[model samples]
Target: MTDARVPDRIAVRGLTAHAHHGVHGFERENGQTFSVDAVLELDTAPAAAGDDLTRTVDYAELAQRLHAVLTGDPVDLLETLCQRLADVCLADPLVEAAEITVHKPEADLGVPFDDVTVTIRRERAP
Candidate 1:
C-alpha cells in the first residue's frame, strides 16, 4: 500500500460575517464580526486536465454556503463554529481534507489583544 500524501489546496481567506456567537449575553444581543478562512485539499488533476468546472469545487457556491453557516445559528465556542465550517468545506466530494479558521476580533477577554482565532483541520474518512 502507498502512503497518503497532502493534496493540493484551494483557499479562501478573509471571509467575514456578522453573527451572534459567544457565551456573553451582550454578545448575543449585539453581533460582532466573525472572519473565516478555508483551505480545501483536493486532487485538481482531473479539473485541470479536462478544463472542466464541474470536475472541481465551485468556490462561489462554497462561499455562499459558508456565509449561510456563519449567519445561520448561534454557537458558544469558536471550536464548534470551526467544525461546522470544516463540514461545509468537506461537503464537496472532491475535497479530501479541509482547514478552517475562525477569527473573533472583538472577543471580550478583558485584555488588549489584536485578535482571537481558532483553527482546525478535518479529513474525509476512508
Candidate 2:
C-alpha cells in the first residue's frame, strides 16, 4: 500500500467573496462578504521532479472554483458553505485531504464578535 502520510500541502488564505448565505432573509437578499482559507494535503514530489503544472494542484483554478461556489448558491449555515468548498478541493485526484474554513465577519449576531467561522476537513474515500 502507498504511504498515507501526506506531508505536503498547498494553502490559499484570505480569499474573500461576496455572496448571499445565512439563516436570515436580509442576508440572502443583500449578500455579504465571506472569507475562506483552504489547505490541501498531497504529495508534491511528482510535480516538483517533473516541474509540471498538471502534476500538482493549480491553485489559481482552485480559487476560481471556490469563488464560483461562494457566489453560486444560498445556504443557511456556514457549515454547508464549508462543506461545498471542501468538496471542490477534493475534486482533484492529487488532493488526498482538504481543510476548509469559512468566515463571516458581518453576520447579524446581536452580540459583539470579531468574526464567525466554520471549518471542516475532508479526506478522499479509500
Candidate 3:
C-alpha cells in the first residue's frame, strides 16, 4: 500500500546573482544582477520527523546550483533563463515539481519600470 500524499512545499526567495546575461551588448559585457525565487515540491515529512537534512532539499546547495546557471551563459530573454532555472530545480530526482521566477531589475527599456520578471512551473516527467 502507498500513502499517495501530496508533498509539502519549500521555498527559496530573493536569491541574487550578478551575471553577464542580456539582450544588449553592454548589458552582457558589464553584467547585471538577477534575483531568483524558487519553490520545490517534495516529501518533507520524513525530514521533519527524523530531523535529517538528507531527506529534503538542501536550499543552500540549490541556491548555488541556481546561481551557476545564471553566471554560466548569456541568454537573450528572461523566459529562457526561467526555463533553465526550472531545469536546474527539477534535476533532483526527489523533486516532484518546481516553480521559479527570475527578476530583472535593470532592463534596458527607454521608459521607467519598477521591475521585470518571468515565472515558470514544471512537473517531473513520468
TM-score of each: 0.95, 0.94, 0.91
Clashing pairs in 1: none
lDDT of each: 0.93, 0.94, 0.90
How well is each residue in 1-126 modelled by candidate 1, as lDDT tens digits? 896776889998999999999999999999999999999999989999999989999889999999999998999999999999999988888999999999999998899998999999999989
Selected candidate, larger TM-score, 1 vs 3: 1
TM-score of 2: 0.94
Show the colliding residue pairs in model 3. Answer: none
lDDT of 3 by residue, 13-113 (tens): 99898988888999989998899999999989889899999988999999999989988888988889989999998999889999999999988889999
Each candidate structure's count of clashing pairs: 0, 0, 0
Worst 10 residues of 2 by lDDT: 1-10
User: In model 2, which regions exceed 4 Å deviation?
Assistant: 1-6
Model 3, position 32, has a per-residue lDDT of 89
How do all the candidates rank in terms of TM-score, highest first?
A: 1, 2, 3
